[model samples]
Target: MSILANPLYRPLFEILRSARNGIVYGGKLRFSHALVINLLYKSGPLLPRMKSVFEATKDHAQVLASFAIIYKIAVHFLQSDAVLGRKNLRLTKFLAGCFGSWIVYSGHFNLFNGGITHQITLYCFSRVLLALGKILLDKYLVCFQPSFINYQGDTMLYKNLNGHQQRKLKNLIYNKSWKYFAIITWGLVMFVYDYKPQYLQSSLRHSMTYIYDVEMDTWDTWREFLGI
Candidate 1:
């Protein structure tokens, strides 16, 4: 009955595993690594705690936390590009807003949990910020790459387009917008879910700590064995 062994966990695990594979076996390994690390910190551990806020019947916060981390990582491949498409000023402003909000939320959560030593809900806030930063970095890297966005060796704007070109432009706009909306919506859902008392538990209140302990040891072993 372990959450990690459950069928539902497979999808999340596969995504992370695939990311690891891409990092190891595919090109752009640094991109994959940056992406995975960003995801692990933000969505992995904090997801289940957010879920525990609403559903009292399910007793698997730790598992959810693990999912959150995995989910954060998987979605980044989809979301970061959207933020990068915007103007630099707008992107910077949006990220600044998110950072300020995170600081307030983190401070409040830490204080509510009793003190800095308690560190409640900080991971959730920290993940949100990390996600935003990753998007910025990804976009910056893309900008330098040139091949993805350059058209006839031009980076400037064009005022006119024919039917075929317009259709392609439309698709690009829609695709970016759809992804941006999805990421924002998902992030908002997590924020709302994390605020409820039902999800909030005293530290060490989870049903399974052994799984995390095992996973931690496994992670360390892999890190050492792989020299990663």
Candidate 2:
């Protein structure tokens, strides 16, 4: 089922639809927020990876544009919540901001570290994006309504999470998921770093190889410098 078809997400969909209609008929300049939302809905899987491209291409303007769109969406969600008193709206705005910030940070970092293979940056950026999703789901269900999850033999949306299963799911989403993503990103970063020497040695004229070498070296040194 489409996310909007689910009762749990119907409210959010209504709000977004209303906002979309408002822009279409109310003559409001909502393109900024609309762009982000459009990309999110239409390119859900690729949304995170696209940020890497923006960064690698040094498209700061596009990155900022995307952020601006997300910012507008945040404001819209907040205002809607204030008017409609849907508590989830507040959390939704919080999620958007958190996700938006992480995306911007990841994109900017990837762009600045553009000396490496875009694939490496793409992988890291995707992890960051996925981390944001996990954070949203964790924060919403754990903090807002720990009892809203269902964990019996058959899974269904909007069911309450039992005590035993709650702890397990919470640990899985909040801790284990993040830990796994971090480890994978670390491995990829290290791989790029170790291969940098070989890649640059073969193609000295390849500026990106050099960039990768420098970026990876700097990251390694920083990690050791901080003893992390």
- Scored by lDDT, the top model is 2
**Candidate 2 Cα outliers beyond 4 Å, as residue runs:** 1-128, 131-160, 163-168, 197-228
Q: In candidate 2, what are the lDDT values of residues 13-118, reduced to their tens digit?
A: 6556654553343222323433453454344567665554444334333444444455556645655746544567666666666766565545454632333333
The 0-to-1 C-alpha lDDT of every candidate, in the order given, reads: 0.45, 0.53
lDDT of 1 by residue, 3-36 (tens): 7789878666666665455334322332343344
**Error in Å for residue 82 of model 2:** 26
What lDDT does candidate 1 reach at residue 193?
46
Clashes by residue pair, model 2: 32-69, 115-208, 115-211, 115-212, 149-160, 149-161
RMSD of each: 19.8, 17.4
In model 1, what is the error at residue 23, expressed in angstroms? 52
The C-alpha TM-scores of every prediction are 0.21, 0.26
* lDDT value, residue 206 of candidate 1: 30
Q: In candidate 1, which residue ranges exceed 4 Å CA deviation?
A: 1-150, 155-159, 197-228
TM-score of 1: 0.21
